[model samples]
Target chain A: MRKTVLVVEDEFLIAMDLKLLLERHGWWVLGPAASVEEALALMDEELPAVAILDVTLRDGTVSLVAEALRAEDIPFVVASAYDKPEHVGGEILAGAPNVGKPTDQRLLLAALEQAIYRMNGTSLPLDP
Target chain B: MNLEDLYRLMRNGHVQAQGIIDTVPEPLLVLDQNLCVQTASRSFFSTFKVDRDETIGQHLYELGDRQWDIPELRLLLEDVIPKSKAVVDYEVEHDFPGLGRRTMLVSAHRLFHPDNISRSLLLSIVDATKRREHEAEKDVLLGELRHRMRNLLALVQAMARQTTAAGRSGEEYRDAFLGRFNALVQAHDVAFSHNGAADLQQVVERTVAPYSGSPAGVIVEPGPTVPLASGQIMSLSLILHELATNAIKYGALSVATGQVRLRWEIEEASAPRLRLVWQESGGPPVAAPASSGFGTQLIEFAAKRELGGRVELNYAPAGLMVEIVAPLASVS
Candidate 1:
C-alpha cells in the first residue's frame, strides 16, 4: 500500500500545490484541510502515516492536532510562515523538521518520507 | 592580520599620518604615548596660528593659557585613554580658536590597534555654532508653549468669575469654571507624567482620577499607555478634563440621579490613527450653552489644531457626545 499524507494549511494556493506535489510522488493524499478542527475530524476516520501542519490555523492553533497525533502514535511536521519552532517546544521541534514558510516541493516530500519512517519504528536515514 | 604586526603598522602609521592631517576640515591633532603633539592638521595650524617649525616637538603646555589650552582636557584624555575605551564627549566653552566666543562641543577618542591596545590619541574638534542656535530656538518654543497654555487657563478663570458675578449662587461659577479649570490642571499634570507628551487617555485620567469615587458613580479607567508629544498632551488633557468636569458638574455626576461613561479607541487601524470616541450617556439631556466661549473655541478649533483632528459634537436626548477623529499618534 502507498504511504498516506495529510496537508493542513489555511491558504488555498499553498495547500493545493502541496497536495499536487505529494500525489505526483505516488503517495495517497488525504483532505487538504484549512482549519485545525477540520484536520482533527479528518484524522478521526483515517489515520494518515504523516501530516504537515501549519502552526496557525483559521480559528485556533495546530497544537491540538499535535497532541492527538502523539496519543495515536502518528508523526507530523510543522510548516508555518509566522511561528518559530522553538515557540511550540524544543521536543516538538526534535520530532519534526521545521519546513519554514514558502517551502520547496522536493523538500516537503523529503520531510514526509523521514516522518513516515520514524513513525513506523524503522531506523531514520538521519536521526530527526 | 597578526596582532603584533598590526600594532607595529598602526604605531608607525600615526607617526606617518602627519601628511594627512592638513586635509581634514575639523581641527585634528595626533598625540604620542607621552601626550606630546606628533601631528597637527592644517585647520588646527591656521586656527591657533603658532609658528609651526618651532611648535612640532614642543610640549602642548608651552602654548599660552586660554580656553583652547586647558589642563582639564589633558587630565580627561589621560583618564579615559588607559581603559582602552572610545568616547565621544561634549564640552561647552565661551570661546575657541578661529571659532571665537561660542559654545563648542569637543569630542575626544583614543586610537587603538585591532588587538585592543591603545596606539595614540586622536582629538577631533567641531564648531558647534549652528547647534547652539538650534537649542536656543527649542528653549524659546518650549517657553512659549508654557506661557500660552498658562494664559489660556487664566482667561478661563477670568471668564468664569465675570459670568457668575451677578445674583447666582456659589454653584454657578463652580458650574461655569470649576470643570474647565480642573481640565486645564489635569492636562498640565498629565504632560509631566508623559515627560511633557500626552495622548487622549492621559488627559482623561488625570482629570477624572480625583473625583472618581464609586459613590460619586464616575469610574475612570485608562487603557494602554499611548505617548503624546508635549504640546498635544497639554491640549488633549485640558479638553478631556473639561468634558469630564462638565459631566460631573451638571451633565452626569452632578445630579444624584445619574453616572458618567468615558472611553476612547483608535478607529483607523491602518496608517496614522484617529481617536475613536468619548460617549457619555445615562445623564440628563445636554442643553446648548447660551453662549459659545473660550471653552468652545478650544474644544472645537484649538484642540483640533493641537491634535490635528475633526471634532463632532452630538447633543443627544440622553447625554452629550464629543467624538474627535484625528491623525493618530503616541508621540511626535
Candidate 2:
C-alpha cells in the first residue's frame, strides 16, 4: 500500500513542484495546502501517513498544525529557511526532524524515510 | 603650618580642582558620598543643557529635571562603585530636558584626599548615541542581506527543479536551467545597480539591448520617469527577458530589419497605473501558438500574480504586441 504524504507549504510554485517530486517517488501525495486552516480541513477528511511542514505560512507560523499533527501521533518533518529551533518555536522543533529550505531532493527523501522508519519501528538497511 | 594657614591652602586646592574639572572636555560631575553634586564641569552643564546653579547644589538624581535618575546607573554608582571603588563604561540611555534620547557611557572613580577623610566620586559621561545607532543599523542591514540571500537560494532551487522537468536529457536540462539562472542573475545585477530602485526607461532598454542586432533594431520610446521597487524590478526583468528571448528567436530580433518598439506611460485611473507596450514590427509574419509555453506562462504569471497587473499578447499577422498594465502603487 502506498502511504499518503501531506505537504503544507504556502509558496505556490514550490508546493506544486514538491507534489510532483513526491508523487514520482511512488508515494500518494495529499494536499499541498497553503495554510493551517486548509491543512487541518484536509486532515479532518483523512489522516496522512506522513506530513512535510513549512515553519512559516502566508499568514503566520504553522505551529498550530504542527501541534495538531503531533497530537495525532503522526510523523513529520519541518522544512524551513531558519536553522535555529527558536526560529520557529523551541517546543515544536524539539522533536521533529528539520531540513533547511533550498535543501537537496536526496536530503528531503532521506528525512522522509527516517520519519517513516521511526513510525514503523523498522531498521534502515545497512549498506555493505 | 598653623590652622589658619592650612585652611587657606585647602581653599586654594578646592578652587584649582574645580577649575580643572570645568576645563575637562567630557561631561564630568563630582558627587559626595551622599550622592549630592559637589561640582560639575562646564561640559556637563552644556551637554545636559542645565545651569550650574541647578546642578551643583542639587542631588545627582534631581539634577537637570531628574534626567540623571536612572535606576541601573544609581545602582552602579552608589552600590557597585562603593564596593569596587570604580565602574567603567556603564551605559545608560536617557532623555534630558532639551536633548532627546541619548546613550551615555558613565565611568566613575572614587576620589580620596590625603588631608580630608571625605570621599567624592568623579563621573565621566561619554555620549555613545551615534555609534550605537550606526552599529544597530549595520546589524539590521546584515540580517536583511542574509534573509535575501536565503530566499534567492530557495528560488534557485525551485527553478532548477522545474527546469529539469522541461527536458529529457541532462545536457538539455543543463542548458535550459543555466539560461533561466543567468536571467535571474541579470535581474539581480540590475536591482543591485539601482540600489533597490530601477527607472522604467532603463529597465526596458537594458532588457532588450542584447536582442538588438543593430543600432536601430530595438527602439525605446521616451516616457515619464517612474521608479520601481526592487521586487518589481526583478519580476519585470524576468518578464522582459522572456519576451525579448522570444522576439530574438522567433519575432522581431530574428531578422536584420525587424524592429521592437518599447514604450510606457502613466495612466490616470481610479488610482494611477503604469501602461507599458512591447510592439514588434517588420518581423516575418506572426501567429498565435497552439498552446502557451513556459515563456508565455512565465510572462503571464509574473504580470498577473507578482505585479498584480494585466498582460495581453496579440499574435497579429504583422507582428506580436504585448501590453502590461499595473497599478503604480502595486509596482512601486
Candidate 3:
C-alpha cells in the first residue's frame, strides 16, 4: 500500500508542483490546502500518515494546523518560505524539520522520509 | 505666612529660579492654583513660538491663539493632577499655531508651599511626534521587505521544480527557467513600484515584449485602466509569459503572417468581473496538445487557483483563443 501524505500550501503553482512531486515519489497525496480552515477540513475527512506544511497560508499562520497535527501525534515537516521557522509559528514549530522554500527535491524527500521513519520506526520505499 | 508674603518670596527668587529652569532644556511652566502661568522657561517660549511678555500671567488655556485649550489637558490639570499630586506622562495631541500638529507627553507635578493657601504646578512638555512616526515607518518597511523576499524565493523555486527537464538539454532547461524568472522579476518591479499594485496594461506589455518582434506581432487593444494587486500581477504576468512562449514556439508567432490580439473589458453584473481575451490569428491550423504540458497546467493554475477565475482555451483551425474571467475584487 502506498503511504499517504498531506501537503499544505497557499500558492497555486507551488501547491500544484508539490502535488506532482509527491505523486511522482509514489506517495498518496492529500490536499495541498490553501488555508488553515481548508487544512483542518481535510483532516476532519481523513488523516494522512505524514504531513508537509507551509508556515504561512492565505488565511493566517499554520499554528492551528500544526497544533492539530501534534495533538493527533502525526509527524510532519515544515516547507516554509521563511528563513526561520520559529519566527512565524513560535514554539509550536520550533523543532520541526524545515525544508525551506525553493526546496531542493532531494532535501525535501529526505526530510519527509526521516519524519515518517521517526514516527513509525520504518521507512517507506520511494522511486529514485 | 499670608498670600502676600508668599508672592514677595516668589518675586525675590524669580530671576535665580528662572535661570535654573532655563538650563533644564525641555519646556517647563509653573502654573498657580488658578491655572494661570506664573512663570515659563526660555525653552518654553522658543519651543511654542511664544514670548514671555504675552505668556506670563496669562490663563494657560488662553495662550497661543487658544491652541493650549485642549479638553484632555483640561481634565489632567483641573481634575486628575489635583487628586493624584503628580500626573506623569499624560499624552496630549494638539495643533499649535507655528508647530502644526504635534504629540506631546505632558508631566505635571503639584508643589505645595509652607503656606497651605499657596500652590503651584510644574508642567514639562516632551515632543513625541518624531519618535512615534519613526517606529510606525520601520514596522511597515520591515514587513514589506520580508513578504517580498519570501514570495520571490517561492516563485523561483516553483519555476525550478516545474520547468520540464525530460527531453531538453541542460541549456534548454536553464533558458526556460530564466525566461520565467525574468518575467517574475519584471512583474515584481511593476507591482512594488506602484505601491503593491500594478497596471494591467503594463503587466501585459512587459510580459509579451520579447515575443512582440514577430511579424503580425501582438497588438494590445486600449481598455479601461485596471489596477491589480501584487499577487494578481505576478500570476497574470506568468500566465501571459506562458501564452507568449507557446505562441512563438508553435502557434501564431511562429509564422510571419500570424498575429495575436489582446483585449479586456469589465463585465458589469451583480459582482463586476474582468474578462480578458487573447486571440491568435493567421497561424498554422491549430489543434489541442496531445497531452497537457507544464505550460498548460501553469496557465490553468494561475488563472483558476491564483486569481480565483475561470479559463477557456479554444483550439480552432484558424487560431487559438484563451479567455480568462476573474472577479474584479480578486484582481484589484
Candidate 4:
C-alpha cells in the first residue's frame, strides 16, 4: 500500500499549497487539519504512516498531538514558523525533525522521508 | 538642675520618642547627626526583614552587610539633608538584603526640640517595588505584542509575493490581495476591541455589516456568544469576508431584495463544538461554479485547517448556503 501522511497546519493558503505538493509526491494525504483536536480526530479514525504538524494552532500548541503520535510509534515532522525548538518544547521535541515555515518543498519532503526511515529503523538508499 | 535630674529627663524623652516611632505605619527611622540608627518603626523592621539587634545603635551602612550602603542614599543623608535641613522625596533603587531590587522614595526632615542642642533626623520610606515590577511586566507584554504584529506584516508580504507570482493580472491581483488584507484588518480590529478575544457574533456582524445595505437587509439571528482567540478571530473573519464578498458580487447580495441569514449553535458532544450556517435567498438562480476559485479554497481550507471543522457550500437554484461545523475550542 502507498504511504499515507497526515498534515496539520492552520494557515489556509499554506495548508492548501502543502496538500497539493504532498499529493504530487505520490503520498495519500489524510488531512490538512488546522487544530490539535481535528488532527486527533483524524488520527483516531486512521493512523497515517507519517505526519506533518504546525507548532502553534488557534487554540493551543500541538505538543499533545506530537506526544500522541510518538506514543503510537508514528513518525512526524514539525513544519512551523517557529525556528527554535525551545519555542515549541525544548527537550521534549529536541530530536524530532522539523521544517520551518515559508519552507522549501524539497526540504520538507526530505525531512519527511528521513523521519519515516528513522521510525522504521532503516536508512535511505544511496544516490546512484 | 542637678546632673541626675537631667539624665532622668533625657531618658524619659527618649522613651516617649521610641513609642511614637513604633506607632508609625510607614517604614520610618530616627537617626542621630552621625547617621547612626537611633530607632526604627515596627513597619521598617518587617518590611526590610531587619531585627532590632541588627539595626539599633548601628551605623546605617553597617546593617545587613551594608545593604543601606547605597551611594545616592549616602549623598542625600550626609550632604543634602544637612544643607537643605531636609530632603523630600529622594528616589533610590537598590538591592536590599533578603528583598530583591526595590524602588523607594526616601524623605527626611531635621527634628527640632527647644530643650535639646543636638540634631536628630526623621526619615520615611515608600516602597514602590511591586509597582515597578508590574510596569516592567507590562513593557515586556507590549514588546511581545509588537513582535507578533511585525511577523504578521511579514506574512502579508510573503502572501503578496506569492499571489503576484501565481500569474494574476494587475487588477485581479490587487483586488484579491487587498480583499485578503482588509479581512485581516477586520479581524485585528475585532480582536483588539475585545482585548485579543472576540465574540463570534460580533466578528460575524462586523464582517457583514458593510454589506447589510439596510437594517433588515442582512438578518443576523443572535447566537450563543463564543470567545475566539486572536488567531481564530482572524481566520474566521477572513472566511466570512470572502463569503460576503462573493454574495455581493455574484450571489444573493447582488440584488436589492436579496437576504442573508446568519446564526450559530453549540453542538454538545464528547467535546463541545460550534455549528454555523449562512443561508441566502431572494436572488439570482445559483449553480456551482465550473471551477473552485481562490475565495472558495480559502473558505474550505480555513474551515478545515483553522477551525478544525467541515465546510459545506451548496449552490442551490434559490441561493447559496454554507454550513461550518468545528470544535468550539478551535474556533474560540
Candidate 5:
C-alpha cells in the first residue's frame, strides 16, 4: 500500500516543488495546502500516513493543523524556514522534528521515516 | 521673631522652593492633602501648556478640561502613595488637550518640612511617549525582518530544488541557480527600500537591466506610478526575471536587433486593476514550447497564486506577448 504524506506550505513555488519532490520519492502526496483552513479541510476527507508542515501560512500559523494531527496521533515533521519553530507554532510544535528550509532531501526523508517508525514500529517501504 | 519678619521668612522660603523645583527639569507639581495644586514647576507649566495662574490653587483633576483626572493617577495619589510614602514610575496614559495621547511616568513622594507643619506631595511627570513608540517600532521591524528572512529562504530553497538539471551541464545548472538567486536578492533590496512597497517601474527596470544592455533592447514605457506591496513586488520581480531569462536564451534578447517592450496602466472598473504587458518583437520566429518548463510554470504560479492575478501568454510568430492583470487592492 502507498503511504500518503500531507504537505502544507503557502508559497506557490515552494509548495509546487515540495509536492513534486515528495511525489518523485514515491509517497502519495495529499496536499500543498496554502492555509490552515485548507490543510484541515484536506484532513477532513482523509488522514495521511504522515505529514510535513510549514510553520507559517498565508492565513496564520499551522498550530491548528498541528493540534488536529496531534489529536489523531498521526506522525508529522516540520519543514520550516523559521529560526525557531517553537516560537511561531508554540507548544504544539515545540518538539516536532524540524527539517529547516533549504532542506536536504535526505534529511527530510530520514526525519519523515523516523516519525513513521516511532508511530508504527516499522517504516513503510517507498514505492518503486 | 516679629510678625512681619515671620511672614517675610515664609515668603522667602516659598520663593526659594519654587526656584528649586524650576531647575529640576522634568514637569513637577506640588499637591496638598486635598489634591489641589499648591505650586507647579516652570517645566510643568510649559510642558502642560498652562500658565502658573491657571494651574496653581486649582484641583489637579480639574486642570485642562479635566484631562488630568485619570483613574490611575487618582489611585496612585490617594491610595498607593499614602501607604508607600513614595511611588516611583507609576504609569498613566491620558489624552491631553493640546499634546494628544501620551504615556507618562508619574512618581510621587510625600514631602515633610521640618519647620513647617503642612504636608505636600512631590509629583514628577516623565513623558514616556517617544520611548514607547520607539520600542513598538523596534518590535515591528524585528518581526518584519524575521518574516522576510523565512520567506526569502523558502523562496531560495524552492528555486534551488526546482531549477531542473535535466539535459544541462553542471556549469549550466550553476548559472541558472545564480541568475535566479541574484534576481531574488535584487527584488528584495528594491522592495524593502521603499518602506515595504515598491514602485512597479523600478521593479521592471531592475529586473530587465541585465538583459537590456543595449539602449533599445528593452523599452519600459513610462507609466503612472503603481506601488506594489512587498509580496506582489517579489512575485512580479521573479516573473519579470523569468521572462527576461527566457528572452536572453531564445527570444528577443537573443538577437542583437530584437527588442522587448514593457508597459503597464491602471484599468478603471468597480475595482481598479493593474494591467502589465510584456511584448517581444524583432526576435527569432516565436513558437509555442512543446512542454511547459520551470519558467512557464513559475510565471503562471507567480501571477495567479502570488499576485492573485491572471496571466495570458501569447506566442505570436512575430514575438511572444504576455499580459498580466491583478487587482489594485493587492498591488498597493
Candidate 6:
C-alpha cells in the first residue's frame, strides 16, 4: 500500500505548502486540515501511516489527537514554533519525534519516517 | 530763568538743579550746543563703566571706549530725537566693561531745560542678552520631548500586540506574554535613557528572565556579555519576545515540568560570530508542527533579515531546541 501522511495545519498557505512538498517527495498526502475538529474527524475516517501534528491548531492542541493515534498504533510527528514539547501534556513522547516550525523539507521528511519506524518497528517500506 | 541764566546755573552745578538729571537711573548724557559730550550726569559715568573724570573733557566721539560704537550718535540725537517729538530708540553694539560686548537699546530724548538755548539730550541704554538665551533653551527642550513621546508610543503599540496574541492562548499564556512584552518595552526605555547605548548584558538578562519563571519550569541563564548595535539590540529583543511568547503558550514554558536551557557564545573561527542555543527538556515528546504560524514566520524574518543570522528549530524527543547564529560585527 502507498504510504499516506496526514498534514494538520490552520494557515491556508502553510497547508498548501506542506501538501505540495509532501507530494513532491512522493508521499501520499491525506489532508491539510485547518481546525482541530476537522483534523480529529479526518483522523477517524482515514488511517495515515504518518501524522504530522502542529501543536497549536486553530481550536485545540493536536496532543490529544496524537494520544489517540498512539492508542491506535498510528505514528505522528509534532511540529511547532514552541520551544517546548508535550504542548497538550507533559507526557514525554517516549519514542516520538519532533520537528520545528518553518522546517526544511528534508528535515521534516526525516522526522516523519523516524516516527513511523518507531511506531511499527519497520513494518513499512524504509526510504533511506 | 532765561536761556543765558539757565546755561550759567547748569554749568555752575546748582545742587537742586543738577539733582533731577543725575538722580535718574537711566544713563543720561548732556551734549553742549556743539554736541560735544559735556558735563554729563553721574549716571553717564557709572552706567557706561567709564572713567568719569577722563570723559568729562571729551566730545561725543571720545566717550567711554565703546566696543561697538556708532559715530552717528550726535546726528541721531540732534536730528531724529527732536523731530520725532518722542523717545527714539535704536540698537547699538555697546562696548561696556566686565561685559565685553553686547546688543543694547540706545534711546535719546531732546530736551531744553526750561530754556531754548541750553540744548541737552538724555540718552538711556538697556541690555537684551537674557531674552535671547531664554528662547534658545526653549527650542532644545522641545526636541527632547518629541523623542521621548515617540518611544512611549512604540511601547504602547508593543503592549497592544502582546495582549492580542495572549488573548488567543490560556490564562497562563496571557500572563507570560504580558510579562515578556513588558520586559521588552522596559528594556527599550532603559536603553533610550542612555540615548540607545544601553549595555547589551543588561538587555539580554531581562529578556530571558521571565521565561525562567514560566509554568513549564524553564531555566534561562544569560551568556557572556557583549555589546550590540542599537538596531541589532532591538531586533534581538523582539526575537526574544516572540520566542518567549511561543514558549509560554505552546512550548516548554507551557508545561509544568518543562525546562529550557539558554546559552550563547562567541565563536572565533574564520569569522567572529555569536552562537545561541535554546534547548527544551522535561516536556512532552516533540514533533513537527502541522502548520507554521505568525510566530514561525517572525523568527525567520528577524533572524535572517533583521539580524542577518541563521536559526535552526528542531523538534526533538526531549523537546524543541533552537540554534541561532549571527555575526559579531552586527553589534551597533
Model 1 / residue B171 / CA error / Å = 7.1
Measured against the true structure, the TM-scores of the candidates, in listed sequence, are 0.38, 0.63, 0.69, 0.58, 0.67, 0.50
List, residue by residue over B243-299, the lDDT tens digit for candidate 2.
877887789888888988988999999999999999999888998989786668667
DockQ for model 4? 0.15
Tens-place lDDT per residue, model 5, B41-128, is: 8889889889888889999999878989999898888789889988889999988889999999999999887777778889999999
Q: Between prediction 1 and prediction 4, which has the larger lDDT? A: 4
lDDT of 1 by residue, B1-332 (tens): 89999999978886667667777888777776666676778887676666566556656656434444655566566675566556565564555555577655557667766775657778776667788789899977885676445444434533343333356687876765566665555666667765666655656666667656746555555555556766666567656655666677667666766666665655556756656456666777788788764456556643454565678877777877777777766335
Better of 1 and 5 by lDDT: 5
| Tens digits of per-residue lDDT for model 4, B148-258 | 664465456544644443666878889878877877778888898878987888888888878786534678898887889887887788888888888888888888889
Q: First chain TM-score in every candidate?
A: 0.85, 0.89, 0.95, 0.89, 0.96, 0.86
Off by over 4 Å in 5: B1-151
Itemize residue pairs with steric clashes in candidate 3: none
lDDT tens string, model 5, A1-128? 87889999887778888887888888889877889999999999999999999998889999999999999999899988676788988889988999987677889888888999999899888555
**lDDT score, candidate 2, position A5:** 89
Docking class of 1: incorrect
Count steric clashes of candidate 1. 6
Give the TM-score (vs. native) of candidate 4. Answer: 0.58
Off by over 4 Å in 2: A1-98, A101-105, A112-128, B1-16, B23-26, B32-36, B43-79, B82-85, B91-105, B112-119, B125-138, B160-178, B189-202, B214-233, B246-332
lDDT of 4 at B162: 43
- The per-model lDDT (C-alpha) reads 0.65, 0.81, 0.89, 0.81, 0.89, 0.67
**Candidate 6: tens digits of C-alpha lDDT, residues B265-294:** 889878788887888777677788897754
lDDT of 4 at A63: 83
Ten-residue region with minimum lDDT total, candidate 2 chain B: B159-168
Q: How would the docking of model 5 be graded?
A: acceptable
DockQ of 3: 0.40
